[model samples]
Target chain A: LDAEAMAAARERHLTLTKPPGSLGRVEEVGARLAGICGECPPPVPESPAVLVCAGDHGVLARGVSPWPSEVTAAMVANFLSGGAAVNALARTVGGRVSVLDVGVAGDLPDHPLLRSAKVRRGTNDLSRGAAMSREEAARAVLAGAHLAEELVESGGADLLATGDMGIGNTTAAAALISSFTGRPARETTGRGTGIDDATLALKTRVVEEALELHAPDPKDPLGTLAALGGLEHAALSGVVLAGAALGVPVVLDGVVSNSAALVARALAPDAVGYLFAGHRSAEPGASVALEALGLDPLLDLGMRLGEGTGALLAVPVVGGAARVLSEMATFSDAGIEG
Target chain B: LDAEAMAAARERHLTLTKPPGSLGRVEEVGARLAGICGECPPPVPESPAVLVCAGDHGVLARGVSPWPSEVTAAMVANFLSGGAAVNALARTVGGRVSVLDVGVAGDLPDHPLLRSAKVRRGTNDLSRGAAMSREEAARAVLAGAHLAEELVESGGADLLATGDMGIGNTTAAAALISSFTGRPARETTGRGTGIDDATLALKTRVVEEALELHAPDPKDPLGTLAALGGLEHAALSGVVLAGAALGVPVVLDGVVSNSAALVARALAPDAVGYLFAGHRSAEPGASVALEALGLDPLLDLGMRLGEGTGALLAVPVVGGAARVLSEMATFSDAGIEG
Candidate 1:
């Protein structure tokens, strides 16, 4: 929906016992929900689903992250085993979380929540070649879109939050953002996981060199993304697109998801309106990407260790906004002098 | 609860496919909820209540707020009339907003959500005399305590949020912060609304004079609160106390609630643990008060306009944290590689 429709829905916020214009941002969220749902009191998606896409970045082979590429497979195993932070946060939000194995180097165990959509064994090292061929990238994006649509259509969720799990995805994201936003690599590269200054410099050089190799044209957003993006990033971009097409709110976690959003918005400007920045990460590139998107970070707690941590932090605020519109007292009900 | 219990609960966080510590803060919140409820999966309070207490601050008589004291009553009327933002936000949060007429000067109309418990109509102007006598302050506290019990015992509210509506509350809160923290008046004073520098200077003078006149003894928190506190402050202190006694979370707003929390915590340290800082305020004293109380504000967007706006913003976060513990997939269930 457009801002005007959201504004109209907001105009219909239920009168609480307290004076009008008193609750500030809480009130804003309520109004936004009203606008989004085209209802005076929007339906709170009681059954929320957070879909986390897992992949391994070829950039990690360039020695970008301290953690070995094996860590990606190990973490995916943890996600499938339900030992990760996103799993806990998703549980806290009363939503189910599923791991979409879009691209992993190793074979994952058969898990109920694990949906195998492995486009390739893993992305190619971008320093050597494109992360994925255009066909493989399309398959990853379609995988994400199909998953989001399936969840919404099955009445399994009222909201779909896109999360990512990849060791060097930030490196991939930095490269993609540089290509898409036409910014230099220095602005988009940051210390991914407490990397030393030397490693950071090296990482930046890798990104810069990859950007030069890719030379992605902004007009062909998907083409650029396919060449420079990781499986998780491309999948997240697809998720954002699907959420927008379905008119559902999609929360972006850190720079990784944000980089995907930048590409998504380039492809579909209307999709940007549905995106909410969960929080600002300590990652320098996050601020730059978020600013480029003209999005406001909901929380800032010096947190950059991703895995949807920031997005999970924002779940309550989003839920609360929808809840306020659905509940609370009206002025007529609370007959004080207000 | 101690940090160990919180950590223990965190350890019980539903495992995901990733390694431990992957989700970070989202996992922390879930674990925090578990520790608060002393359960592996805490039960989310389904019936939440936001108590918006309206009163006329004695300091308002000294030109602290540009808006007349009558606006407090007018806003209360708007709140009851369903024209206020709080009304809209509360509706979204699925909360019942109750307006307590603890100390409004105007003759409020009868309304369903409005409950009268006026303490001597209003407090005496602090510049002239003590804002309230010890007995009057106790009565206001008692009223708040009673309200909390009523909402929880009979009204079926699972969570309780403290809100307020009174002109010049910031003035009173500033005075309290100055007296309690032994901060200079300049350090504590802030522009309540969009006040000019001249009005702010005058407001600061008023706060200093009131602080000097009261000379509230830190040893006796209630005595200090009685001498300098607004009716709503006293009432809110009582609400925190009652919430603690009832084992419910008390979501706190800006400096006003922060001041009340200080008083309440002085009375019962356990109550301090029950409080969640909804958001930080633009008020200069707010950070001081929050720092003194060791509260980590959930949201901080330079918001100073209080009507329990901060706490209202935080409600969904609380709900979502509870939900995550209750609903998210565990390591075993999701079959990912945590």
Candidate 2:
């Protein structure tokens, strides 16, 4: 983010018609875009690609989510078939969707939209052992970074959105959030896919046991990810870092993506500037993660579905912010006195 | 709202690829759209017109808003000349804009988009007496209804959005909200356009004084409009009613529009079904109005701009909700099992 470009954007905002600061966060969004792109009027993000990272969580063995782990592969197939909510939303916003099988338990069939980047079959049960070795976690993170680079640099995507499709992944996400934000497991855990109260209690207990066993350190994000994070979390974190490194904006989805963002921020604090929270999730951990990251979500539809549908809905809003700066006539340009 | 259409939409939601209630408010929005238009898959709101209602408030004598009263006419000119934030946002969302001179203190130059329906020079000082006579208030309300009818019936607009331009109108809005919601004036009053602590205190006092003077009845909406509502308020209330009578969706702007919505709801409880809150305003009164109306705003950019900009941005989201029903493939249609 360039201070000079931000100052220029603020100056331009003042010259636009209506009262100063009247546009509120919309004006701030434009300024942030300008600073990120180093221009008074940042280029509109024309090409947005949502990366849906699919992985299985070993914690499913403990009955965290009501749905079986096979649902992860099933949902990925839905994404490929363009029959999922994320696909519908992305199509509405003119965004492209790509699925990456980073660590699904079942081998996904070959598909044009599905990218093969499996780090392992699945992470170990966090309640019993480390989710992944540090090297495996780093490898998954690097694969995500590479995918993001390919999408933005070669795939002609100007914006990146994070999505996740893994059954029982919310348990891993809650564990990550609880470890990073120092919140209680019960406070961070939520029923993914609307589970019964007994399952929710079991999920919370599983997360508590994982955190106690791992004692993940906040300062070392990779170590924490290795201890408690799912493969999708590493990949999403990689996507965030890649967006920051490449100077592209990344819109994060619900609780799973937000948990990944915490790791990404710890790895590179500047990465926070490149990220936009797409929506507040119904999950309790999402608020804690967003507050810790100092990002305000653009929408809050009480959505808990984590296929990047919420973030996809926000792409137009992000584009509108830039358009206000790039396309709108200023007071002086229209010969109207302030 | 049509009960049959709403039920059909809910059934359609279940047939979609996600779990029940997973899409949260998005599904609710789709159901509401179907009910409003009386269809299983409601037509996308392609033709949206933002009615920017311009007025003057005699309450400016109380020194509520820091900006001069002339900004109303100046901003109306800005709107006509396509230099205002509302114009920029409407353009971004492919929505048309029309400025209504309901009660500007100064004469505005004639333009193709400007509609001259001035009720009076401005409303009388509420602290002194009724803002307008009961007949005058009724006339203003009728004018708004007529404009809305013209826009939706003949003008070919599928959606109607409300905007307002009046200095010190926030004070009037706070008073109306205080009267209806029974909250303290200080709790509802806020610094309009960023006022200092001294001005905020004075604005709160003005609202308190006006509320005491008017002793407005919650049940009598027209009489309340006569007592404390601005001309734009009456006109906007009329717009809400017209949208309901005609079964068109109406998107509301900030505090002023919210205050008018209160009156509209009081007059016609069914009118609430036709309204959508565009964004949550920074104004305290906005929350009260939205809560009383039971409408959740789509965006919360902390915007205080009252030119329909927030609502305009939300036009796409509204469109997307409908498109999800109209365009997306169902689970059975795509051969996916739910």
Candidate 3:
């Protein structure tokens, strides 16, 4: 955060025509944008992009999710074809969609919107062994960071949003949140993608078993990611870190992104400052992660879809914050009392 | 709510690209909008207008507020000059603003955005007697409803948002909420515009005393309004009722609007269907009023500003809901299966 810019933004807020602090969180959002951009009136994040990180979770074999793992590849194809919820949301919010096949069990064909950045075909089932080797996890993280940098610097995106399309990935997210937040698996686990009571219970058990098998260390983010994190999780964490490094805002989606945020925050505490929880997910672990990060989501529509739809919906609000700071007349400018 | 249009909207939602209910509250908003417009794929609420009802509270004489009653007229001037927070937000959200001087204590000059609809110089001090006569309250409400009708029918505004510019109106709102919900004054009262702890306590006591003196009935909404409601409150309630009668969506601002909504709902239960709680107010009374009306606020920014700022900010989200329904590809069109 840029202290000078933040101070300037706060000063500007007090001078605006409305009562001081009457805009509440909207005012804070503007100030945060200023700090991120190192300018009193930060540039509006007009070019928004939702980066959908596609991966496959090996935990699906443990009956953790009712949907088949092939749904990941299928959803990736849907995203590329602009036939998914994220695509609709992006269109609605005037944002672009980019899909990265970070780790899919099946080979995905090249497409215009798809970026082939596979770290591995899939992770090893955490209940059986570590999800991935530490080197592979680090490579995935680097790939995500690099992609975020490229999108912001070269692709002309001013804001990056996180999205995921991995079946049974919620199990990994729950495990990661449980490990990082020191919460029990049952507390962090939730029904993903409209699972029934039986599947939810099974998913909870799978998360508990995986946590026991991995015994992930919270102190070591890389070790934790290697032990239980999915390839997409590591990549999304990279996106957060890269957004922080590049000083652009990163809007996070549901539980998967929240889990990734926990890992990113652990690796670089300052990264959390650049991140925005777009909306509260219906999943239980998302709240835990957001609480840990001390982020208040912009929306709570009970949305749990992980294709960046929730985050995409929030893009206008983020833009509005910047617009208010940049365009609103000050009390003196409008010849009104403060 | 129109059952035929609502049923059609539900059908349309089931056929949309996303899974049933995946869009969560957003999907509900779309359906409600459809019901409001009496058609499937309801027209986008493109032309939004925020009606800011300006008034003075007679209770200000009781030392319930630190600010002078003249601030109400001054703020009305500021609003007309586009120096208020409401104007900035309206500009940001691409909405028009109209300020109604329903009950300003002082005389006002004419302005482009100002509508002179004075019911009285102001209401009588509520702790001493009824705020206004029963007929005056009804006339104020009719003025609001008539303004809403004219704005939508002739002014080309497709949506109406409620705003208010009244000092010490929060006290009247708290009293109204306490009367309607049967909540204690202390539970429903909050510091308005940065009141000190001592002022907040005094405000609560004033609310309790007024309620005790009037013993207003929730069933007799007009009588209650005459007893405890501000002139602006009566007008806002009229706006809500008019919106319902006209079948146009009305986005409500904060506690003052919520209090009026309670009265509107009491007058016509189905009127609640046309209303949207734009954001959760920082004021304590807002939650009680929303709960009584069974409405969920779209934003929770801890904002206590009452100049339609919160409701104005919500314009885009409401627009997005309609856009998703009308523009997004359905499952069949996108060649995807739910």
Candidate 4:
């Protein structure tokens, strides 16, 4: 991010039509975009693309989530058919959806939008041992970065959004957030897919056990991620890094994506500059991760659904923020007294 | 509002291939629209229109606002020329913008978008006496109602938003909110248009003095409106009533529109059901009025710009909420487990 460009955008906001600081978060997002692009009056993100990385977790063997691992690949098929909530919400904002099968337990059919790049069927249970080897984690991250680069360059996407679809992904997310933020498992764990009180208690204990089993150092971010049991997490974090390197903004969804962002931030501190917390999730883990990342979410609709649904809603908001800088007349242009 | 239709919409949301309650406030809004329209999966507000009521306040003589009254007329010109924040924002959502000159103090050039229906140039200074006669308040409100009706019927607007452009209007809004909500003037008054601490104190004092002089009963809503000095408030309240009568949702801008909503609620309690508090303003009085109206704002972006810009931004959210109900496939249709 360029400090000079951000300062210039802030100064330009005061000169625009509205009163100083009236646009609030929108103004801040505009300034941040300017800094990201190093351009005063940054280009409006006209085309936003969403990447839904689907993986299965072996932690489901621990009964972390009630749904079978098969649901992950099923949802991917639903996404391909444009029938899921993510598809409906993406259409609302003129966004294109692309699904990446990083590691789904079941097979998905071929489709134009589907990028089948499965590293493995699923991860090993994190509670017992490392989910995957460090080398495998690096491969998954590279796959995500390559796809994100393709989306921005060839797909004509100006904005990127991170999405995840794993049956027990939230359980993995809680563990990753607890490890990265150094917060207690109880604070980071939440009810994934509306679990009972007994299940929540069990989930929290599982996260605590995983952290204790592999007290991964936060400084070694990739190792921490590899210690965790989710291929999509590594992949989503890859998109964040790729977006920062490409100077395109990446909007984050709820808990799953936010946890991935923590990993992204750990790997590349500058990646946080290219991120937008699209909406605060109902999940407790999301708030902890967002706070650790120092991000103020643009929308707080109490949505916890992943599949990039929450972040997709914020695409127009980001576009509108840019429009305010580029479209609205200044005080001088309108001939109004300063 | 039909309770049965709302119940059907709520039930439908749970089956829309997402987890229950994951969509948050969008779910609530979709059901509300269903109730208002007596239809399951109510139509998306495809053509939302914003009606900006431009007026002037006689209370400007008492130093309530720093900006000149002429700025109101100039801004009306800005709106007509598509050079204001509201214009840029409305364009972002594919919404049409219409300006009604309910009571600007200066002459405005004829424009196709401008509906000249001035209810006197301004109002009398309210600190000393009534700003407008009871008859004028009713007329201004009627004008607002007529414009709202036209926007919906002829302009093909299914969603309505209230906007204001009077220089010293927030001072008048504070007084009205205090009167209708039964809150003290100091609690209701706020920093309208970024006033200094000294001016805020003076503005609070002005509201208190006006309330004390009239002691307008909340039961007589029109009389209370007459006792207040802003023409836009009456007209904006009229838009609220007309929207309710037309069975279309009305999105409110900020403190000014919120105060007008309070008046609309006082006149007809059912009108509150048709209103959407678009975004909470930075003004303190907005919270007090929203509490009185029992409306949850869709966005809390810390914006105080009151040209319907805040509400206009929420138009897509409202539309998307409806689309979720209308366009999304059910879990049964997608063959997902119930």
Best by lDDT: 4
TM-score of chain B of each: 0.94, 0.98, 0.98, 0.99
Give the alpha carbon lDDT tens digit for every residue of A51-88 in model 4: 99989998999998878887787788889988887887
lDDT string, candidate 1, B1-338, tens digits: 44665666566653533334434454565566666666667777687787888788767777777777877887777777655656655654667888888999899999988889999666778776888888888888888888989998895687888888888888888888887888978888888765779889998898888878878787788888877888998899999999888777788888888888888888888777778887887788888888988888878856665777667767766776676566555655644334
Q: Rank the candidates by TM-score, best first.
A: 4, 2, 3, 1
Question: Model 4 chain B, poorest ten-residue lDDT window?
Answer: B329-338
lDDT score of model 4? 0.89
Residue A3 displacement in candidate 1 (angstroms): 5.9
* Per-residue C-alpha lDDT of model 1 across residues A14-94, encoded as one tens digit per residue: 345443444455566556666666666777757667788878888787788787766677767766666566665666556
Runs in model 4 deviating more than 4 A are none
TM-score of every candidate: 0.82, 0.92, 0.92, 0.98
The worst-scoring run of ten residues by lDDT in candidate 2 chain B lies at: B328-337
Q: State the DockQ, from 0 to 1, for candidate 3.
A: 0.42
**Could you give the candidate ranking by DockQ, starting with the highest?**
4, 2, 3, 1
* Per-residue lDDT of model 4, residues B126-242, tens digit only: 998999999999999999999999888885689998899999999999999999888999898988889899999999999999999999899999999999948899999999999
**What docking grade applies to model 3?**
acceptable
CA shift at A304, candidate 4, in angstroms? 0.8
Which residue pairs in candidate 4 collide?
none
Per-residue alpha-carbon lDDT of model 2 for B10-92, expressed as tens digits?
99988876767888888888999999999989988878999988889999988887677787988888888776788878876
